[model samples]
Target: MAQKLQTGTSKTTRYAIWAILILTVLSTVALYASMFLSQDNNYKEAKVQQDNYKKYQEATEEYNKKADKQAKELSAKYYNSFKEFRKTPSAFKASDVKELEKKDLKVGDGEEITDKTTEFYAYYIGWKPDGSVFDGSFNKDELKLPLAVKKNNRGWGVIDGWSEGIQGMKVGGVRELTIPADKAYGSNGSPNQQDSAKSIAPDTPLKFIIMLIPKFEEIPQPNYKDYGF
Candidate 1:
């Protein structure tokens, strides 16, 4: 009877091992099936995102090309009109410029700038008393697009001399402004992006040749979602 019990125990252990191995095989098969079924959806999502990004890139490129062309054409037209006044003054003294001075180069017959709150577009060249050009709206030989001067509490979002000097000036006009140090950059001076070597000095009087022009065609901002940005 003891011999028979030992044989039965061995058979039961073998059956248990077989059951574990079958369960493991089924689990592995189920895992692989699940992965296989979801692969199509994952691939579709990746393709959709890729297509949207491509569309965004194309649209942005087209928009930039058109805007650049329009700006260059506008710059070329007005640059020819204002190019003659791009000359340094013969004699200039910072101390002599105690008050804001204005010398009209070409007076315009267009709309008159009545108040400090008037918004306009302008092309300008600013220099020091020593005739060093610190900044301007020019790109080497060509003029860049006119910068939009928005209205502020002071005047056209500019310094005291510019606000006072440009008042009563009409569109399509060009004027030369000689600003005193107090009305210009004042004591702290200003930075020069064009010539990083020559920054505006403290108590430095400045001069500017300004040309006012009419507003250009507005370019709407591209939607970020449309560009996938």
Candidate 2:
């Protein structure tokens, strides 16, 4: 069994919900793996990685808590800025996911988001052509879109397809990316795949609605300066 944190209506935020969703899938494996390691008295490097993971999550929760009020405000600002571009997330007919494609619904005047850019913040909704919303950051005020791919391995800001697709988006832009499975979860679905009322199967092409947000809290990534990975 996994450990549970004390959460109440008063303390809950969208960010917290995001954390729970992430931890639910990934942390379980880490927790159980750490338990097995202790019993076996195994390799110390795994222990180090385990400790790093715990510390990273703790630091993140702290940041998310502090950024709660600010994040909502940012979401609102982005909403207003992109309201015209916003649309309900919907999917398309079966298409090859191997071919990466992108089209802009709304364009922004801000700086381009590139692999060299360190900070990334965005709001997104992901669904299939059938109109099933698999995952999204905001319940309202977002758009017709695709992935908010981050520049590099930097904590995998988005999927491989997203990484390439979201390259030139301005801070205020909205884009729709159609990703083939190869750039997404591929044949092996993600271990941390969001739990939805609808199932996301392996090898399924995905349609995503993404809005590159400015002024939201900075996404957490390891300091490359300190730890070169």
Candidate 3:
């Protein structure tokens, strides 16, 4: 009877071991399936995000093209209008302008200009080669302001054409300057003006009537070491 009981006990122990082995195998398989599903979901999400980004890039490019096109059209319209205006005899005729003449200018010939300076001045009317008024200083009465030349400012603030054109002009001298766009505002006109007035897109000509005023000296340069600045 004792031997029979021992055999039964061994059989029960073997059955329990088999059951534990089966459970472990099932758990491992379940864990593997979960991991695979998680990775697949992440891959799908990444693909979708990439597709969205591609679409966004394409849209941005299209928008820029459209904007550029519109800007060109607007510029063309303005350029044509300006041309038409020039054709009119009245447009070329201004009562304020006494005469049109050309004068050669030299460097360092004008008044000695320091870093920061101001001058009271008047001018007739200035035009680009296209006969557009680039500087309407003559249209106004008096201009009194400091001309800045430092970084982020209109340093050495002189229009290229005006500076070069009025070299030998005596103080209180008057003259008309017909400047090419290259000498005036170049491809991009002065900032803060209308787009139509810019030199870039339309690249219109420039003209000017300049009057010289008394030149003033600029403030002396500060010694950085003295202020420990």
Candidate 4:
């Protein structure tokens, strides 16, 4: 074992192997880091989309509730009279407007009305078959509405049904009148949409609660020009 130069691995070979190992480790680390970042980004995007979908569902629910409420209010017109209607009549039906039907809810002690009185100092609520109010005179002080028939053989101020229906009613008496379309605006229906979202349809039946007995007076003359009478 004299001094023999032991040359194990050369420096170049050792350096090359070390470099390859270092490069492989760096590449593996880079790949794992990139995969983690990508997964994180995907998770964040999915969460945001889910939140957006949840918000949309909530908004749609709210809108549906609001719409249901509005629809209920709109349809409430059919039964509103149950609050104070003393004698709710039977379900009304559409019939030919050739006759008038009258029923007394309460008879008064006052004298019966006369045809000489062209107008009556009374108050009334004109309700439709569905219990929706189409018109009313009770809002004003003792309303002086013209009678269906005048003193002379004059034209009817109101509908013919009302004229015939009020025949035997006395002052302070309440009467319910069922009027036909012919006695009202006729088959053409009223052009004035004065009720709740319902224009009086043609051939529609009408009901009325009329009360008599007040100071006799006259309303101001209506301008035909203004009302297109």
Which candidate leads the pack in TM-score? 1
Alpha-carbon TM-score of each model against the true structure? 0.66, 0.57, 0.34, 0.48
What is the TM-score ranking, best to worst?
Answer: 1, 2, 4, 3
lDDT (10s digit) by residue, model 1, range 1-229 = 5664444457778899999999999999989988987997889878888888888777778878887787688877887887777775444777788888899988998888876445788899888887777778888778776777788664466788888898888899999999999998899988757877569888989899999998777666568676444
lDDT assessment of candidate 1: 0.81
**Which residue pairs in candidate 4 have backbone atoms (N, alpha carbon, C) closer than 3 angstroms, thus clashing?**
172-212
lDDT of 3 at 160: 66
Local lDDT at 144 for model 3: 23
Best by lDDT: 1
Report lDDT per candidate.
0.81, 0.68, 0.49, 0.63
Per-residue C-alpha lDDT of model 3 across residues 134-160, encoded as one tens digit per residue: 434221223223232322355335656
Summarize candidate 2's per-residue lDDT along 1-229 as a digit string, tens digits: 9998867664558779889999897989899998997866766766766777777677667766756655566655566655543456655775645588898988978889776787666777677657677777654543322223444455556687777878898987889888887788788765443555456677877877677765433545444233312
Off by over 4 Å in 2: 1-65, 83-86, 96-98, 140-157, 191-194, 215-229
lDDT of 3: 0.49
Worst 10 residues of 1 by lDDT: 1-10
| Stretches of model 1 off by over 4 angstroms after superposition | 1-64, 89-91, 153-155, 192-194, 221-229
> Which 10-residue window in model 2 sums to the lowest lDDT?
142-151
